[model samples]
Target: MGKSPSVGVLHEDDCDEVKFFEKPRKNLQSDDENVDGRPGWLPDGWIMEVYCDDDGTIYRYYICPLSGTTFTTKSEVLDYLFSEMDQCFLESKNHAVGSNLTRTHEWLPKGWLVEIRAGGDNMDKMYKFYVYPPNRVRLFSKDDVLIYIKEMKISGFDTDGQCNTNTQENILAILEFNPEGLPQGWVKEVVFRKTNTGKIRRDRHYTDPIKNYVFHTKRSAALYVETGKVTIRAFVQKTSVHEMYSFEKFTHLHESLWKRLELGGTNQLRTRLSKLRKLSLKEEILSDEQGSTSAEDCNSDNSDTAHGAGQNKVSHLASTTVKRPRGRPPKQGNARK
Candidate 1:
């Protein structure tokens, strides 16, 4: 008979160290008992075979039942199992979506589930929404949900074809930040602006009371408060005098204020404004210097005028007292006659 290939024996080059062992027996019992009569945490049908070297060093190899693949560590087996579970979950979600079995949210694509659960502790009667995507990953916030949806679209996983404009609007409506939930002294502001394409885009801003900075998103506000650094896009605007009024009045502030509220909420506006102030200061200084120079010239002119007047008076006295020749002396011939 031809020689049969041995199983569960890894090549020496495959691992850092080489180990030799006796052929493992077939039909092993439970995973725990199969591991040299020791308790193991491996799932059913997984085999943990022990090996030894001449130096009395021990090595363990794990075998996957379904694929007959060999692994050197328990973590590898667990990772394989998790990957298998994810595949299975994905298939199930696809099936559910095709059959219209899963509950759908107006905002989310079909096959995605949204669960509303009553909040615990201080939340009391409040309810929180938890989203479950087709991948079975639980999402807790609107930002996370949006990110997941974006990734799905990028990966071509939009099975229901419901990730349309209306669905997006519904999602935004549901996930919109509630101004009433803001902390004391913190405000939420929304500014509607037209893009270069003339599409109306709504920008949401959150104020951090502790840092006194305005962030474009709540996550950014929290991050700034935690790190003491503005890690995201932020804007600086003059505190409005109309802040005490109602929201409508605040929104209706001067048109110039709206212009200041545009995007690029980083140091761009700040640096630009600073440069303007510096230019204005320079102009003012130059004007002051010019004024001082003109004043000095005027004073010198007045001094010169006074001095000339005194000289004129002296000259007038000389002209009246000393009868000096008013005209050139008579010609020499005329004098002789």
Candidate 2:
């Protein structure tokens, strides 16, 4: 197999190929495929290369075509690729990896942050790619990165507590990363916002921008030529709102709690709680004292009745005899009533 990670034996017909490989290609099957599951086809843009080592044992390799994945074997690449499960029922259940590589992305309303690195045990070898749905573009040269961010369909990228301007230059700096630009996510909507002409005209808006029309991430710089009036329709998704349960909760609570405490002239939450505790304790003590005084007064009032009344009281008792009917009765003392 070629040193390029895009190595695997797949039938040329089994997997989709790039427009560059228009001719017929060979199908290189791998032994590393699932035992029960049939071997999958090569992915488009990727090619399979096979060569025997000095020891005659056959080894298969799956390589990423856009390059830079450390998967040394076909099995490794298959594991990652099969997550999307390339299958076709019409092809006798033999679903090979075939994707429309040239298809534009159905851009999300927002963007995501993607981590890219060579496939394998390599960790330090990493690249960072950011996707801005506004442009339907990726900032790196890795297929897995593109596939990952698209599949994730993240609503938006994190601001990371830092506010960065989405200026025209900033967008261009990130999107147009040298080499050659790869167009993935498709831009479905493009509405032009005319300058300060009182109100936007209905028929003046445009949906399709010419191919050469440069795309920018910023909405304010919608117009290719800055007439100061905004021409492009750039609607950035609202920044994600921090929920009540988010860390902002603690920050907000901290301020409010401190303010409430400050009104009481105490600056500590613990001190405020302690004051409440003392008030509660004092109330409990007062209630206990009142209950004790009431009990004492009642006891003193009942003392006279309990003492002299005992002497005036008299006791009486009587024993009754029971008669048994004609029957064999027990020889014990007559039944007492």
* Local error of candidate 1 at residue 266 (angstroms): 25
Q: Could you give candidate 1's per-residue lDDT for residues 53-168 as a string of tens digits?
A: 68655568887654455788767777767667334334433433332212122244444433322222321222223345456564544455677778753222321332232222
Candidate lDDT (C-alpha), each: 0.49, 0.35
**After TM-score superposition, what is the CA distance of residue 263 in candidate 2 from its true location, in Å?**
20
| Number of clashes found in candidate 2 | 15
Tens digits of per-residue lDDT for model 2, 1-337: 6686766787877566553363332122335443233235666756555556686444545555443333556566777566432221122111111211112222312343222211112111112344555556544434444565668443433334232334221111121111112222212222212223223222111111212232333332233212224345433322111111112101222222222222322335457899999999999999999999999999988997886666555321222335568988766665652
In order of appearance, the predictions have TM-scores of 0.23, 0.27
Clash number by candidate, in order: 0, 15
Query: For model 1, how big is the CA root-mean-square deviation?
Result: 18.7
Show model 1 residue runs off by greater than 4 Å. 1-182, 240-252, 257-337
